[model samples]
Target: MARFFVSSDHIEYDDAGCAKNVLIKGTDVRHIKDVLRMSVGDTVTLCDSCGNEYVCSISDICNDFITTSVISAARCGSEPRIAIVLCQGIAKGEKMDFIIQKNVELGLNEIIPVLTEHTVVKFANAKDAEKKQIRWQRISEEAAKQCGRGVVPIVGMPDSYKNVIDRITSDDDTSTTLYIMPYENETDRTLKTVLYENKDFLNEGGSIKRICVFIGPEGGFSKKETEYAVSKGFTTVTLGKRILRTETAGMATVAAIRYEIGD
Candidate 1:
C-alpha cells in the first residue's frame, strides 16, 4: 500500500460525511503526479502523524497535485511493545547522519545528539549545527519511509553530555529503565543477561514501556561520564568482549531491545 504522512490539521472529519477529500501539496505532490504517476481513482494510504491512518482513493488529478477521498480511518499501524530512545555521543562528519538513519529503521523513537568532552568535531557556528541537524533529520525521514515505519523518529537538537544524562535521570520511571553502553573495559556481564533476565518486563500497559540506549563517540565516553551514567542508574552493560564501532553500537542495542520485547 502507498503510504504518506500528513499533518493532523489536514484530517478534517469522517463524521461530517462518508467521503473526505484530501489535497496534497509540496514535494509529495510532485512525487504522486510525476514520479508515482498516480491518476484519478488510485488507492493510497494517508496518515496523520498522530497515529490515524486513512485509506484514500484519488478523486481528482491536477497539474501539480492529486486529490483523494478517504475510504477508511483507524489506528491499525503502530510500533510494537518497545519504545527506544537513543542518546548518542555526537560523532564527527557524516557518522551522526548514518546513525540516525539506521537507528530509525531499527525502530528507535528518538535520537539525542550529545556533545561530549572528547568529541573532536566542532560546529563552527549555529548555522553549521542547524545544517547538520537538518541533514540528519532528512536521513531519518527517508529511512522511516523505506522501513515502513508509521512515524519518523525525531533527530533532537544537540545537547551537552551532562544535560542529556540529567534529562534521562529526571524522566518518569514508568518507562523501561535500561541504559546500554558498549564499554571497552567493563565486561562484568553481557547484554544477553540483562535482556533475557527481564523477558516479561515489556508487558502491555506495564511501567516499562520505553528504553534508553547510550552509544559513545569514536573516542568513546570518558571514564567519568560512564561513571556518571552508572550513578544515574544506567546498567553499563557490554555488547560483547570485542569492541564494536560507534555506528554498530546503536543499531545493535535497538535490535537487542526489539528482540527482548518482541517488537
Candidate 2:
C-alpha cells in the first residue's frame, strides 16, 4: 500500500473523533490517479501529521481529489518516542540534501541548517535562503514518505550558530531538552559515555522529551564556537576516534542515540 501525508482538515472524523474518511488532494491526486494508476477499492495509507495513521480504501477518484473510506486508524508506530532535531552546519554541494534524507529515515523530528564560522556556502540573499529552505523541505517530505514516517520532519531556515545555541539553551523547560554537540577535540567524553550516564533520561517516563544534535561543517567548528556552545549547556562529545564528515556525523549520532534509547 502507498502512504501519503495529509493535513488534519483533509481527514473527516466521526462524532466520537475517529477518522471516517480521508480526502487526498493536490499533486498526490495526480500521482494516485495517473502515476500509480490506483483506482477505487485500492488500499492506501494516510497520515494526518499528528502521529496518527489511517488505512483506507479508495471510494472515488476525480480530477482534483480522491476520496477514501477509512478501514482502520491507529497511532503511528514508526515515530520515535523521543523527538530528535539535527542542527547541522550546512555543507557544500549536494551533501546537505543527503544529510536531510538520511536523518529523516533515522526518525529525526526536525532539521535546522546552521551557519558556522567554517561554513563555506553563503546565501546570496534572503531569496536564495528561502529557495534552499523550500528545496530542503521537499527532500524531507520525500524521505519521510519513502521511510514510512508518519510526520514529515520540518527543515528550518538557516540559522547562525550562536542564535541556535541561544534559542535551544533558553528553553523554559530545560530539563526536557538534551543538547549534544559532536566535536573532534572532545576525546574524553564519548557519545556512549554521555548516553549511559544519562540513561535515566533515555528511559521511559524520564524527563527528557527532545534531543538536539549539533554537527559542524567541513572545516569543523572553531575553538571559539565550540567553547561558546559548551558554555551554553551543550554537552560536547566525541563520536569516535575517526573524524566523520559533516553529513556523516549527524546520521551517525542519530543512529547511535536511537540504538541507545531503544527507539
Candidate 3:
C-alpha cells in the first residue's frame, strides 16, 4: 500500500478525537487518481505529522481530491526514541540532496543547513536560500514516505554558523540536548567513546531529548570554527582515522548513533 502525509486540518475527527476520515489534496491527488490509477476501495496509509498514522480506504475520488475512511489509527512505530537533528554544512551540487534523503531514512528528526567558513555553496540572496530550502523539504518528504516514516523530517532554512551556535547555546533545555561535532582534527576522543560515556545520561529516565550532530562541508570546518563550537559546549569527536566526505559524514554519524542508542 502507498503512504502519504496529510495535514491535521484535512482530517476529520470523531468525538473521541480519533481520525474518522482524511482528505488528500494538491499534487498527491493527481498521483493517486492518474499516476497510480488507484480507485475507491483501495487502501493507503496516511500520516498526520504528529506521529500518528491512519490506515485509510478510499471512499471517493474526485478530480482534485480524494476522500478516505479511516480503518485504524496508531502511533508511528518507526520513529527513534531520541530525536536527532543534523546541522549540516551545505555541500556542493547534489551531495546535499543525497545527504538529506539517506539521513531521513536513517530516522533523523530535523536538518539545518549551516553556512560555515569552508562552505562552498553560496546563495545569491534570501530568495535563493528560501528556494533551496523548499526543494530540500520536498526531498525530505519523499524520503519519509519511501521509508514509512510517520512524520516528514523538517529541513530548516540556511543559517549562519554563528546563528546556529547562538541558538544551541541559548537553549534553556541544555540538560536534555547532546551537542556533538565531528572534527577531523579531534583524534583523542572517538565517537563510540563519547556515545558510551553519555549512554547513562541519555537513557536515565528518558531525560535525554535531542542529539545534534554537526558535519562540515567539503573543505571541512576551519580551525577557528571548530574551536568556537567546542568552546560553546559542542563536543568534538573523531568518526574514525580516515576522513569521511561531507555527505558521508552525516549519514555515518547518524547511523552510528542509531545503532548505539536509538530504537
Candidate 4:
C-alpha cells in the first residue's frame, strides 16, 4: 500500500473513539489524487511521523486532495533498538546526501555535519549554509520514508570542529557511554578492543543506549583536530589497519556498532 505522513490533528474518528477519517492537504493531496490516481475506497497508510501508522481506506477524492477513514493504528515498521548519533565531517558534492540517506536506512538516530580543518569545500555565506541545511533536511525526510523509519533522523546545521566538541561535552556527558573517533594512526587499537574495554558499559543495563561516532573528511582530521577530540574525552579507535575513505569510515563504524551491540 502507499504511505504518507499526517499530523495528529488530522486523525478523526467514529463514536467508538477510533480513528475513522483523515484529511490530507497541500502537496500530499496533489500527490495522492493526481499522481497516484488512487480512487475512493483505496487503501493507504497514513503515519503520524511519531511512530504511529494508521491503515486507512480512501473515502473521498477532490481536486485539492483525498480523505481516508482509518482502519487501524499500529507501530511503524522500522525502529532501531539503540540510538546512534553520527557526527560526520562534511564531504564534497552529493556525498553528504548519500551518507545521510544510507545512514538513516542503517538506523542512525542523528546526523551532525562538522567542519574539519581539512575540509576542502566551504560554504561562503549564511545564505549558502541555510540552503544546504534545507536540502539536507529534505533528504532526511525522504530517506526516513523510504526506509520506513519510525522517526526522522535530524540533519542538523553544520558546526565547526571546535563547536562540536564543546556542545557534546557540555550538553550531556553521560548521554554517551562511548565517544569514538577512529584514527588512521591508531593501528594497535581496533573496534573490538574499544568494545571490549568498554564492556562494562552494557553491565548497568542489558544494553547500552547511546554512542557518538566521529568521522573525518577526505584528507582526514589534522593532528590538532584529533588532539582536540581526545581532549574532550573521545576515545580514539581504529577501524582496522587500512585507511578508509571519508564515505566508508562512518558506515563501517555504524555497521561494527550494530554487529557488536545487536542493534
Per-residue lDDT tens digits of candidate 4, residues 183-236? 998877788788777776744463466788999999998999999899988888
Off by over 4 Å in 3: none
Q: TM-score per candidate, in order?
A: 0.90, 0.97, 0.98, 0.89
After superposition, candidate 4 runs with Cα above 4 Å error: 13-20, 63-65, 173-176, 203-207
Report the CA-based lDDT of candidate 4 relative to the real structure: 0.83
Query: How accurate locally, in lDDT, is each candidate?
Result: 0.78, 0.94, 0.93, 0.83
**Candidate 2 Cα lDDT to native:** 0.94
Q: Which window of 10 residues has the lowest lDDT sum in candidate 2?
A: 166-175
Deviation in Å, model 2, residue 47 alpha carbon: 0.3
How far off is residue 171 in model 2, in Å?
2.0
Candidate 2's TM-score: 0.97
The better-scoring model by TM-score among 1 and 4 is: 1
Q: Deviation in angstroms for 263 in model 3?
A: 2.1
lDDT of each residue in 1-263, candidate 2, tens digit only: 79999989988889998889899998899999889999899999999999999999999999999999999999999999999989999999999999999999999999999999999999999999999999999999989999999999999999899998898789775779888999999889999999999899889999899998999999999999999998988999998889999889999999999999999
Q: Candidate 1 — worst ten consecutive residues by lDDT sum?
A: 10-19
lDDT of 1 by residue, 208-243 (tens): 767788888889988899999888877778888678
Better of 1 and 2 by lDDT: 2
Give the per-residue Cα lDDT of candidate 1 at 84: 86
